[model samples]
Target: MLRKSLGALCAVLMCFSGLASAAEVPSEIKIGTLYASSGNYAGVSMAQYSGLKIWVDQKNAEGGVFVKPFNRKIPVQLVAYDDQSNTATAATLYNQLITQDKVDILAADFGSVLTSVAVPIARDHHMLLIDQTGSGATFFSKDNPYIVLTSLPMSSVWPKHVTAFLTREGPKLGIKRVALLYATNDFNGTQAAALRDAIKATNGAVELVYDNGVPTNTTSYTVTINTIAATDPDAVVALGYVNNDIAFLRNLQDSGTRFKWLFTIYPGLETEAVEKNVGAKGLEHVFTYLPSSVMAYKPEFGLSLSEFRAAWDARFPDGKVEFGFNSVAGYTTGLVLEKALAATDSLDQLALRKAIVGLSGKLKTIDGTFELDEATGAQIGETQPLGQIELDEHGHLRFVTVYPPELATGKPVYPAP
Candidate 1:
């Protein structure tokens, strides 16, 4: 049975070699990346690729990583494939990378659904998978040994930020009631649940005038907007992806259904896409949450953010940046893998695993110090930052912080009439 399984795995690996570069291995430090560079989520994958490329360039410039197997420093090589935004396709691509490509390490995809398939594939082949973008809580709960979640988990991502913002600005904005709208997708459902739980915890009398879920790809958001408008809530929170968020925002403006506050999830008011399409007039006082403090656009971290963004912009001059978590996900994932690799003298799979799990003992990133629980894959002590979008005098999108006063640039202005 063992022989058969090994044989099957080896066969899968060989398939990857067909298209892979025939270049000789200068050293044994090779890693694999799987993402949707085409198809539905190309925007996300391209941004991630840009960030990864920056790190790769930097590492190579520094003379690469020390590989135990090679007994010398070796440049890290990544065998990346485009999963094309299809879950099944992503799974197969990842399997080929792990079982066939024989990549020493694996990097997961950008979102929850994509990562769901990538995680198990990595575990099956005993490759250490570092997740920079996926945030579903299920990844943390599952009994997987070869996985590390490097971003803010959704289960606790938005609730606290939203609740704190509301508590601070609710009375000021005269917000007594609100509506919750979400898409019936994993991303929206997770955010909606977090918002609901937050509202409950705060003891705020914000009535959930409309608690409803819409189909994921519903084109027309007019009915949804009209329904929520009819409730006369002081605020409306739409938990959605970029498409859904933009649809609802445009629909609300077209119908002229005004609200004091418009809370959103995913690529909400903070992103360049939302700002450009929704416009300043459309989202003057909307609130959005980002997974880390970096999203606040704080000048305190200006030095670091500027350096990183400059590096990315240099490589991706086509203005193909992934606005919110995508670039951060890819950039941070590279950092995590580098850290794990540095602890060991070798590229051996088992040694790499020890370095990763060893990370659980002390989790630190440019974002902040957090820990990966040994028992649970969850990263502890990480929190999301709250932000609001408004146009600057130059008409460029500006991100203003509204929570954690130490990092906040402006106070929350709610109940916009």
Candidate 2:
């Protein structure tokens, strides 16, 4: 009889302990994000994804984010998915994150294309969006209080700095003719429109000699280069993806057609793959707008661009740095999210978003100043830094800041010398 009583008591204690553990699991901070880990976009998305993962690792190590409402610190659980670089795949994964995984916070993927898909979903779910690198202007045109951009400005203004540089500096070299080739997608289309408007900055000093919109699927730029060469513009600009940029440069090189200035949207400021594929001589004197480079340093944010690169190098020795504007966006997204979480100290979606709106000019990052137009959800404070691709004294190619006099690393080299 005594033995039977003892077994019953032991069983009751085990049931109570199991219930206690379940209660603790519900209080954790859950962060959900998706990225292209194994496709055309993987080269870029993996770098950005690493930034967020690293942040989560650091926070959890420090006992996760402190929550005032819970009256105790809670660890973070990062739930991520591989989108395979397909729009359809990303959309499906987003639904899973919302319905199946039921994550508390939703973060965006690598670039504008992928992020565009998540904007609507975040609004429908009334979830706060910690936007990564999706800077399209369309997302901000509507009412979406649950979103905050931490990297780059609206897509329409991405080329503002580079355009201003050409407008203010082009006249000195008698540059009067320009050519523009862009992809048909929203990102490139917006940039093309901005370039057209940027012409007014020159006050008729520079005119568009060639403007063309090519389909995104084009595999070769042989005919495109021949078409542009016929215009004989003083300078050439292209708004395209990595592959497009590579094709454009290759045809221009093989055809022996040269221009005074050649600037492109990607493969320069957005990714390091261009340097490897185009070779040093092919990329010399090219120009692009860098949202943030591992080359530049900003101390106010307590983030080190060089150190981040070194850490990435050490952790993933075989992985490509892919270090560029988007990589900075990835890391900065974590910083922005961390601040907002602490400011609210609650998982309530509305409270989290309110904290982000309240955090404007007050936040300075390695990427530059971060301020949002609360109404439009547009990023207004950050400005683009124009970078020139040049060979250093040691003959290694580097993106050196040239425009905006304030951020100039070296004198500008024109005509692709």
Candidate 3:
């Protein structure tokens, strides 16, 4: 009887210990994604969120990221917060995610203005902050140790491509005069400086005839439009987000101002906005600078462009997969974070930061193979292609590669004459 009782006690103890161990398994790893889904940047932000969800869904299907140290996998749960396109709201969301939600890691918001606030807040809390969308060179300053810039800064590709295009074709087109416009925001300010630098580099006699930076909430663009029209420049380069770009274009249409070339910035090159707002007729024969993703390049990434496009469209059918660079950007960011965790085996901020900084050495991302630049600590990628836009028979914007004969999908159309 005594032997039997001892054996029963041992068995019970083993059962209890096993239960305890199972309970210790982490249920989930929390991550926070901040984006403006309701306000100004809603179009692009919504697309970004959709792309992120696809990655999250797939990862969860695979039982989430494997935490090597624990020898277990933990599902990733995103605590998404909408900033409503306000910087203050974004800052508050960052605080709440870090202090209350206690997410394992934090992602910088979709725009530079939003990231400007979130970056400092993450730095204050000593958390790892990966920049997913915001790409002003100013954000890549050496001061912010907690912040990591994963995308190619607007400065990196914007100026160089513009300069190269102009150097080869400026005199041919008689595009000597230039007008510049930018949004009164951090990202645009950084880009304006880069644009000026590009103009100087070309030494092609381009004049900054009309330079204006309008407030974010500027509703009426009549004055700005008239001023740009008065300049009568050969080329007009206006740098703004989607809304600002649309408004400026509408005002330009109202004012009946047409230029040889209009280099609108960033998301304007997106097919959705071009179709809905600019219209096929409105955007016809316009040249814009978009990221390399739209122009096509094969750099030996583990994944192909077609795979990325198919995955994106399958997830968000209503969303525009045309210029899915930002979506790819967000997805690439999530993958990089996963790889970093796998390599470091820890979610500790410092360990993750080190892993991120060391990413350039070993990782191959979908955007292209890139490593961190020692000078700016930003991931530098390949050059972007210059693409022109035209309307199809259905009034949809068709992006055609027009520069660098090697990647030319079609010939360049200048002056639209």
Candidate 4:
């Protein structure tokens, strides 16, 4: 009789413990992020912010996302701020997200320049930064596991295809002399260094005639174009952001000084923005990184490219934010969070990091295969392939994947006529 009484007591205690665990689950998951409303990074920043919103809204509509620890769905609450494109402002806001709002998830802004400020802050606070598009090489180190790059590969890895084409295919196309021009920022600076090292490793197979770095804010490039023209380089590689590319291309067009081959970053990444500022004729025959916004990658998780694009249009009919690579990046960040939450054992920051790391090579999204360097949390998959822009018969712009034969959609048109 005493034994039976003890068993009943134990059952009651277990039931209460289970109830306590369930009660500990928070009512909502707070996701904190920042966006630039007005500045050089404004266009891409807003696009990314809109993409994240799409995910949050979609999940809430379906009765919230599943949390494994609680074994139940919990609604997401987004806590966001505008940094106005200032790094100092971003630093303060990042701290506020952790200490003040106490967000469960902390995400950075659009690109490297903005994301740079959040890296150390997140680390100092022991929060995992969901880096959306900042791909600077310096940002990732073995010592810091407090960050993860979700959308783009590291900046140093970005020029892999570009270097291959320059060293191997470039010689075949009669491209000997090359000129390198880039914005002096973390994003373009690292790429310039990588490209320089790759070209130099060729041992005179290719030569850099005029290599220069200009301030990121410099809009006028007529003098720079003239300088590069004097070098008579067969190819001119201009690495910069949307504004820099637009100004450089416009200057090149106005000066009527054309290199045999020209390459720029934004023509494909921010297609609509670049195309709108620089006409079809300006971007024609330009080489760029073929963005996932145009190239469809079969995803194992989340919405497909076409489906996400349709949803973006429906939500943003006014077209204030352009749908491009950054837009896809923002949504990709949300997908990572969703998967992490579903697999995490608890809400502890380190637990969330472990859950995300476990998803490294397995999670394939619209952005491409989501793989990470386990030590540094830097993205290693979803590489950017080389592509060239060509105007169709209708004068509409189209991308032709040229390099990396396995994924090549069409041959490259060397020596722009």
RMSD of each: 8.4, 5.5, 4.3, 1.6
* Span of 10 residues, lowest total lDDT, candidate 4: 290-299
lDDT ranking, best first: 4, 2, 3, 1
| Best candidate, TM-score | 4
TM-score preference between candidates 1 and 4, better one: 4
Which residue pairs of candidate 3 clash? none
Worst 10 residues of 2 by lDDT: 293-302
Candidate 4: regions farther than 4 A off:
1-19
State, as a TM-score between 0 and 1, how close model 4 is to the true structure.
0.97
Scored by Cα lDDT, where does model 4 land? 0.93
Query: Against the hidden reference, what TM-scores do the models get?
Result: 0.83, 0.89, 0.85, 0.97
lDDT string for model 1 (1-417, tens) is 999999999988886775363343455467788767676567667666666667777887888865544445578787888888889998988898887888877887776777888777777777767776666666765567777776545445645667666656575667868789888766567777877776776576555678999986666798878888889888778876677787788887888878778877654422666666677677767777755434533322112555676676677676656445566557666766777766765566667766766765365554444457666565554566677777678876566778777778887665565
Instruction: Compute the lDDT for candidate 3.
Output: 0.71
Off by over 4 Å in 3: 1-25, 152-156, 201-204, 266-269, 296-303, 318-323, 361-364, 374-376, 392-396, 403-406
Model 2, range 49-73, lDDT digits (tens) per residue?
8877777777788888666555566
RMSD after Cα superposition, model 2:
5.5
Which residues of candidate 2, in runs, are more than 4 Å off? 1-26, 200-203
The lDDT per prediction is 0.68, 0.78, 0.71, 0.93
Candidate 2 collision pairs: none
Find the 10 residues in a row with the least total lDDT in model 3.
295-304
